[model samples]
Target: MSASPGAYRAPGAGLRALQLLGIVWTLPNTLVGCVLGVAGLAAGAHMHLRVRDLAIVFHRWPWGPGGALTLGNVILHTGDTLDSACMTYAHRAGHGEEAPIVLADHERAHVYQYMVLGPLFLPLYLLCGGVSVRNRFERAADRYACEGRSWWPW
Candidate 1:
């Protein structure tokens, strides 16, 4: 059972500050995501919002969530199953609600990319031929997400 609307918890002050930093860090991208999010919300899409460490995460299905992170830390979760941006499936698994838990690292990597590459990240991602680990952006994000993790089993 999901939490009722009355049960929704507001993020803490520190998390709100970090969320502000993220908005400043990503700027235009965050703005775009906000616009999209607002539109989705206006259209009656169900929203799940939270702060995962330093990032403000959201889940609103029915717009065909791409299971990838975009606009810094904003995750577009449309799939029935959760997968991190590195293309790894969720450790425990869930519907949209589990996205931040599963895809936080991967999405944060994209946030870093937005910081480093600014607006260029998008076009470069496009120019690199889009949506594959073969793409430099995707590869970099994967590396960032997987950093310091031991990969032996899966």
Candidate 2:
């Protein structure tokens, strides 16, 4: 059968192993995402939960987790979601059907970022620029997700 527009396949064992390591290393910031979940609840955002591959995902959040946390070194939004240290929280996107797959790949790349950058990802991500599609981190993540397919809209 043909795959849907945004269909995705899970990463292999080696990548999953690295993602596990990243999850452990980035726990401090992941806790921040938990807090935001509470905040989102208080603000009346309904969180839809799921486990996809390595990250726990929260979808359909009302208020955003924010672009970046100043002191926490936490990133709360990527594309239409927040790719935390261990979990990815997202809201519904008005974009096309391919959005989920695209965002998932990009966020998976962020998990790798946690592995590579450890405590420095935030500073460097901001130094390059924030979460714009043009930012180095975002661009790199996009590239990582696409696996050099070179067919992205951003």
Q: Please report the candidate that would top lDDT against the real structure.
A: 1
* Tens-digit per-residue lDDT, 1-154, candidate 1: 5442113257789966865675576677767766676666665544444444233444544475356446654555554333333243322232123222335555655665665565666887688767653566654544445552311111
The runs of at least 3 residues in candidate 2 whose Cα sits more than 4 Å from the true structure, single-residue gaps closed, are 1-17, 46-50, 64-101, 148-154
lDDT of 2: 0.50
| lDDT of each residue in 1-154, candidate 2, tens digit only | 7543235567799977876776777777666666775565565544444345244444444554533232122333323454322211222222222322345555655655655566776777777767664466666655554453332223
| Residue pairs whose backbone atoms clash in candidate 1 | 65-78
lDDT of each: 0.51, 0.50
- Candidate 1 lDDT at 9 equals 57
Tell me model 1's lDDT, rounded to 2 decimals. Answer: 0.51
Lowest lDDT 10-residue stretch of candidate 2: 85-94
Quote the positional error of residue 67 for candidate 2 in Å. Answer: 9.8
Question: For each candidate, C-alpha RMSD in Å?
Answer: 9.3, 7.8
